[model samples]
Target: MSSLDILIFIAYGLVILLVGNFLHRSKEKENSSSNYFFASNSLPWYLIGTSIIAANISAEQFIGMSGSGYAIGLGIATYEWIAALILIVVAKYFLPILIKNEIYTMPQFMAYRYDNRIKTILAVFWIALFVLVNITSILYLGALTIKILLDIPLIWAIVGLAVFTLLYSVFNGLKAIASTDIIQVFFLVSGGLMTTYLALNATSDGNGIIEGFKIIANEAPEKLHMIIKSSDPNFTYLPGWRAIFGGIWIAGIYYFGANQYIIQKALGAKNLREAQRGMAFAGFLKVLIPLIVVVPGIAAFVLDAKIDTPDGAYPWLLNTFIPSGFKGFIFAALIAAIVSSLSAIINSTSTIFTMDIYKNFFHKTASEKQLVKTGRLSGVLAMIIAASVAPLLGRVEQAFQFIQEFTGMLSPGITAIFILGLFWKKTTSNAAFFGIIISLPASIFLKFVFPAMPFLDKMLCAFLFTSFFMVVWSLLEGRMKTYPKAINVDKRMFKTDRVFNMVSIGIFIMLLALYIVFW
Candidate 1:
């Protein structure tokens, strides 16, 4: 890369920090708990939609998912495509109840739906998951890219990314994160597409992107399959139809519906309709993500990239294919994805600890000022702790698959407790609590007992197991009586306007065509 590229990257970083700090200063005049955490419910549909994709892309998709694409072929894109459909289901059904009840956090919803004990338990669980698994994995993956681009040690790369995130997060909260995320998504999408161009163009030996596509299709037909066969070596990872109708749903629903960082943007929307429309908007963008992330990996594979591991595919593409002048814009794009996502999670973790843990148990009488202060301090502390632990993640076969499958161990249990508890009137707090407790052990036991079982299959079985226990316990408590806290519902609450419905239908058709073409 040229010196000009380095200056471009540096200038971009300064711009982002300046934007965040400017927002921070402007926001301080009206600082309040709702203002800091939820952007004072002022987010419009566009910001909500863009910010969701910005936060969702990050190192996990860029580094980790592309690694899976390199190793497992384009089939890994099922994660992105399936999420488009699930986002609709979540918006139409889940968001109505959450928005109506004025839910600030996922744990608050658990408290309203079941009991405070459930709230507290899950609050602690979420705080741990966000810090240990979610935050650290992202930090590790982002560090890999930084190390490649800057030619720095891995530990220093990790520390630099953490500091980049904290510069915006501790002071600005969701307002800064959300506003700046619009710019982040722009870079994420544009830069990702640029990388895709480099990959495909290089794959064609400079023929063209279309020629590159044709070459990939002719040479790697097996890689293009949407469904993995039992005979395929990667079948255990994907498991054919199981990816469509089985445990993947458990992961998708829980992630799009219950994950605090993803859902927090929607929670801060101008209104319920805005959030639903925003989700629908995000679904459309989801369809395009594969071209940016997965296609580049497939291109790497087709071009015979000699990467050391699957996760090395993206960085290898950047180094080998990127032209001298474009490196700065591309680096800025990658940094935008990493920092934007890290900031979103750090802000959400601070929200959970402050509202669900600190305010609820540690200082019940704390004022809004104190709560806001705690949110900032907690953001910094979480960043420090996650940065410290990130370097320990070492190497993985595929960080994206590892995250989804291992996290599946917990997702089914959570999906059961939340989804069932939302709709099933007789669900008891005891059953919900029991479901949460039993999820991990059941998943581990299943893995050991059926060592060859596809993780997708294992996830389905575990979900059914935990759901059965929840149902049985609830029914035994009393078959006919609805829990007092059960959410009251009417059909109108689930209804969407014509525009949203049309968008949903369009997304479904788009997904159908994709599977049909690729199947």
Candidate 2:
């Protein structure tokens, strides 16, 4: 990129930091643990929705998923499209229970439903995972983008991204993170669409988006199919029909429903209605994500761009097709995606550690001011560790697939525990603990023992196995003398505003149409 592009990128970062700091300072009077971690439970629907998407659609989606799109075609979009459905389910079913509990963290919810032992165990696990895996991977991918596009050293790029994220997020906490996410989402979507448009126009030699579509269809129709046959050696990761009706939901529900960082925005909403509405809004955005992240890869394919690796597809498109000033804008958008995610997971890592581990175990009598201080310190420490470890992840071929395969092992068991705990009063704490403990081993056994079985199918098998053990163990233990106060199981709690309902239906219909057209 030219010097002008670098200036534009720097300008974007300054704007975000200023906006976030301004908003955070505006709320200085309400300094408390609740304010720091949950945004004082005052976020409106639009902020919640945009923050959710901003936190979710990071380097993984832009870099890794786009790479998959280049390598495996539109079938890779099954993850994005299916996540829309999962978000709807999470909003209607999961948010009500969580909001009613007035819980700050997922592990806290586990503690309430079962025991502190469970909460402490999961809390430690999530903190370690976030620092070691989530933050590290995001930083690595983001730095990789800058290194490739700007000829910068990878270590310097990693440090730059980490410092930029910490500037906006570490001091003010979730309030700052959510407020800045609004602007981040704007850049993320608009810049992404701009890149897509340019790539498509490039494919068609400046004719039009419609012409570009026709070129891709005429040249490589196979890339447009949403479904792939199992026998096709090229697309084994997405094993045909199972992509629709199999282990994907286990992964999806765990992410949208059970994950701390993704659901923290919802938990911070002004009201349950706003949270539900925000999730529905996010679901709507999910439908559009693939257009920005995935279609450019297909554009690269149709234009016959020379890319040595699948992950190179997006960077190649940006370097080749985007103009100088516009390239800076898109680069800023890419940084926005990366920083938004980094800020989010960093906040959550601090949240889990502060509320679940530190407050619970270290200082039960700690004041609200002290709690906030602990959270900030934890956020800095987590970022330092992640930045230190991120460069080591460069060896992985497809960072996206690596994340999915590893996370899938834990998701199935966690999903099972939550599903039963929410709906089944008979489920004993022992059963839930056992389910969580057995998931990884079962997933690994299936992966290595039956090497031919697809990963999604393996996830399904592990989920079922964990679930069976839960039910059998619960039945053997008999009903607890007293169960956790059953979550407000009333159907009224699940009701949505009329606008949300209408938009949800519209999103569902659009998804159906896409599947029918692409099937």
Candidate 3:
């Protein structure tokens, strides 16, 4: 790497740390649980929107997404596009309930709908998931990607990202995270687009964007196809359209709507209105991610990038496609993305642990100051656990698959509880409680005993079984004592304000155009 490149990378890292520390220091005394955990419920729709997308679409999207596209053409886009549709459901239906109830974490919602026991159990489950799946898998994969590109040691990268994230989350809390995310997101988008454009130009050899497509069309026609054939090695093509539409759709809804890491940003909304707008904003962002992450892989294939493993496509491009000085900036952006995601997890994990577990179960009368302090302590502790465990995740071949395969187990169980708990007033707490428990064994059976079925199919079976049992138990044993009184729905919350909608509409149109152009 050139001296200029190294300078750029250093500049990027320094800038992020400075900005994050600045935010943390600025808000030190605003250290209430709401401020630390939810940005004092003051984030506008735009910040909430960008932060959610940035948090969810970290190195996993940068690394694993292109790999999936390389391995399976556009078939992997099911994750992004399906999530777009699910965001609509969440914004329209679920956001109101969560915002109205003032849920600090996903488990807090469980406590409200069911009981403290279920809340504590789910909180512990979530904390474990964060360390095992999120901090370990996502952080490890992200660090590995950086290590490969920059020739830094993987362990150092993990520690660097973890410590940087821990500093802000431990001291400043979610306000710092959400605020820094506003800046980090700009780099994430700019860096992704920069790499994509350069890759396309290199593939076309200055022939222009049109020739990039021609090169791809002539060189590897299979890479351009959206539909996968049964013989496709990348993903299973069996079980017909049911797997694609029904099974995948159900999973997508569960993931985007109920997943803690993704939805926690929205849960911290300033109000019902901001939360709804934030969901719409994130939905629009998801639509553009394919353009940045997937399009580059197509360019890589056309460029004949050493494609032994699809996972290598992204890192290879980062090394060869970008110029040196700019490479540092992009590297900085990647680190920023990693840090942003890590801080979000640390914050939410602390929230769940402190409120749902520590206070509710361990210290019933803990003061507000004590709760906030405990949250900070939990954040630090969670960071230590995540950093320690992250090294184990370095072996994951594809970041996306590792996340989905593991989180799929927990997501479905939680989704069932939330869906029935929120929408069905008659859903007895007992039923919701048992419903989540039963899903585990059923999912385990399907995963270990019957690998022949697509994982989605197994999830569907488990979900249906749990849903069936919940309904039967609700009817036979008893109903909820009373329909929980409805929280006032803010009409202003559901309405899309003018400022974000204008840009969101443009992105939506662009997304539609891409679908048509690629279709």
Candidate 4:
């Protein structure tokens, strides 16, 4: 990279810091717990939407998913495209119940539906997961990209990213995170597309974007197929038919619906309409993510780029093809993805700890000011812990699969419990608790005893087992203990806004067309 490239990168970092601090200062009151945690419930639909995408599309997508695209072809894009469909379902069916309840975190919702014990258990689990798995994986992957592209040391890269996140986000909380995400998303999308365009241009010998696409289509047609065949080696990971109809929904609902970090953005919206609209907007953007993140990997393959590991594809493209000044802009985009996700997880971790555990148990009478302080402290501690653990993930062969395997083991049970709790009036607290307990053993059994099962199939089996257990246990417990009254959510609350309904239809149609074209 030229000196001009280094200067551009430095300037990008400074601009983000300035923008985040400016947003933090713009908020009138900073002491209120609600304002600190929920961005004062003032974010509009556009900010909420862009923030959701920014938070979700981190190093994981750029590094991990692009790696999958390099190794597995366009079949890897199923995750992103299908998520566009899931986002619509979640926006329509899930967000309404959450907004009606007015909860701060998913665990808090669990408490409202079940008991404080359940809430506390899950809260601790999530806090640990956020630090250990989510933050650590992101930091590791981001550092790997930096090391590959710019020859930066892994530890310094991790520290630089962590310090940048803390400087802009820790004190001001979600307001800074959400507000900066608007700008972050712009850089993320623009840089991602620029990389894709440049890569495609290189592949087609400077024939331009459209002709480049045609060249890739004709030269490497296999990479454009969206569906993996059962006979294909990649089927074990994707499991064509099953991916569309089975375990993907379990994982998707858990992430989009019950995950605290993802849902917190929706919770911060000014109204249900805004939240729903924001989510629909996110769904639409999800459709475009593959174009930016996945296509470049395919282009790398078509150009016959020499990459030893799949994760090297994106960085290989940047270092080889992107010019100096433009390289800095793309590097800024990568940093934007990393920082936005880190700030989000940090803010959500603090929100869960402060509201669910600290306030509920340790300091039941804590004032708003005290709670806000605890939140800041929690964010800092979580960041430190995650940074410490990030370097350890260097030993993992595939950082993305390492995350998915462990997270998949737990998602089935959590999804079963949440879905049952929401819809099944007969579901008892004890049943929910035991159902969660059974899922872990079930997942382990499937993993070791039936080693041939696909990971998604294992999730499906565990989900079915847990769901059945919850129903049976709930019925059996009813004979001995009194069941709590069912949650009284008004049916009318599920109604979709007219604009959201139309937009959702358009997204679904687009997804259908993409699948049919690629299939």
Question: Each prediction's TM-score against the native?
Answer: 0.97, 0.97, 0.90, 0.97
> Roughly what TM-score does model 3 have, to 2 decimal places?
0.90
Pairs with steric clashes in candidate 1: none
Candidate 3 lDDT over residue span 1-519, tens digit each: 678878887777677678777876443455577677777778878888898887887778888788876766665665686577677668777777777677667777777788777877777888888866777766788888877876898889788777777766677777678878888888888988888778877888877767877787788777765545556565453243444565675687676676677787887777777777887888888887887788787777667788678878888888887887888777777776777888787877888888778887789999767888898888888877777877766565476465657667666677777788877766777777888888878888888888877776777777777888888888776634444532345556556557546655665576566656654
Model 3 worst lDDT run, 10 consecutive residues: 479-488
Please, what is the whole-model Cα lDDT of each candidate in the order they appear? 0.88, 0.88, 0.75, 0.87
lDDT of 1 at 467: 95
The sequence of per-residue lDDT tens digits that candidate 2 reaches over residues 389-461 is 8887876647745665777788899889888888787777888888899988999899889988888888889
Report the C-alpha lDDT of model 1 over 1-519, residue by residue, as the tens digit: 679889988888998999888887444543588888998898888888888898889888998888888888888889889999999999999999889989879999999999999999888888888897888888988887888788889999999899988987778878778899988898899999999998999988999999999999998878788899999989998999888888788889888899999999999999999999999999999999999999998989999889888888998898898987688898889889899888888889999999999997899999878988999999999989998888877755366456655677888899999988788888999999989989889998998999999988898899999999999998998676898888887789999999899999999999999999998
Misplaced by over 4 Å in model 2 are: 26-30, 395-404, 479-488
Q: State how far residue 238 of model 2 sits from its true place (Å).
A: 1.4
TM-score of predicted structure 1: 0.97
